[model samples]
Target: MEELGISLSFSRPRVSNDNAFAESIFSSIFSVREWVDQFIAWYNTEHRHSGIKYVTPNQRHFGLADDICEIRRSTYEEAKRKHPKRWSRHIKSWQQPEIVKINHPRPIKSVEA
Candidate 1:
């Protein structure tokens, strides 16, 4: 790898979780809905990764990461408005249903011999 000027890093074999992010990328590559190679092609060209401000890695590679925040934030706010009521800081106790009074009288029970 060094001969080709490629730098590589390794994590401990037992600590797979340490490399989970990279492993997850590979796992998703195989598990994505579309074909792996095709998805990877599209992912590289089209999919915007959230980690790098929702710009595709290729965009970042080609120096297009600037001013993407406004676009991302605007989309985020638009999504927030569309979402259903999720929660509130102040909560009220559940109100019970209104009780209705019954006007009928109770029947007397008969004694058996």
Candidate 2:
């Protein structure tokens, strides 16, 4: 690798959750180029990512995240109310986050006297 001026760094073993979704997409039936295009389309327009409150990335991009989240919240609330015993706690949060962080850095605390 060094001879080709390339460096390879591997993430820790058994810690591949971050790459699981990509792996699943790439392992689909489509060919490489076709899969890339298809994956992009699906990811942006169709796929509802849990990390983003189950809305498509395009929805968030177009500023429709809040509206969609509200709808989801209402749906869940109604369902829970209709079947109260089906839920043991409050309805799941469908709130759209103002910011999304990947591998977010930990904040450092300041020491006071």
Candidate 3:
């Protein structure tokens, strides 16, 4: 590690991009670790992930995501109602699934009789 100048950092689960970005910023291993820590904190608490209906991971973890999504859904519905011409189609869904998986399984096509 010392000869090659390689630094090891533990980043957030399922987030590969953070490790490389932090590593490229500084040469010091401690710097990488520190930055990764800060990034993880901010990512979980402040970042609104679209995967989770634009709610922070902390909000989803604490069971506040449902209410937040409900508010968004209501607001969007109201806006569409007032301005029908603005949107040509349906509004985006704020509904969060029971399991937030990166790869959802393809629905099996049944053979119709």
Candidate 4:
């Protein structure tokens, strides 16, 4: 694995988020080998991922991510302004995440003994 530039880290059982995403894709109605190409197209161009502020992967790849996120932010702001009482504090943020991690470990806190 090291020769191939792959790092192997042990993860807890059934705790991989990437595995869940892959499982969802594989468990679809279409056959895996036959429909993988089409699925990839749809996943990249059509699917809006919540992890990326609901922008499709294609948009991010083509540098349209900022424009799309700006539109979403404007829409949210307008809605919040229209119904100020409906909101408790602030409107939902439409900003794109600065970082995306898969199966990243949680920070450990040390207890002073």
Whole-structure CA lDDT of model 4: 0.79
TM-score of each: 0.30, 0.58, 0.63, 0.60
lDDT of 4 at 24: 81
Candidate 4 residues 43-106, lDDT tens each? 9999998888888889987889889889888988998899988888887777777777657899
What lDDT tens digits, residue by residue, belong to model 1 across residues 1-113?
A: 55777545466533437777998998887777457778778887899765565567676666556546556556555655676364333232222212322364668899999
Model 2, global lDDT? 0.83
lDDT by candidate, in order shown = 0.59, 0.83, 0.86, 0.79
**Whole-model lDDT, candidate 3?**
0.86
On a 0 to 100 scale, what is the lDDT of residue 103 in model 4?
77
The C-alpha RMSD of each candidate to the native structure, in angstroms, is 23.0, 14.9, 12.8, 16.7
Listed per model in order, the count of residue pairs whose N, CA or C atoms clash below 3 Å is 0, 0, 0, 0
Say which candidate scores most in TM-score: 3
Worst 10 residues of 3 by lDDT: 7-16
Q: Please give the lDDT score at residue 103 for candidate 2.
A: 79
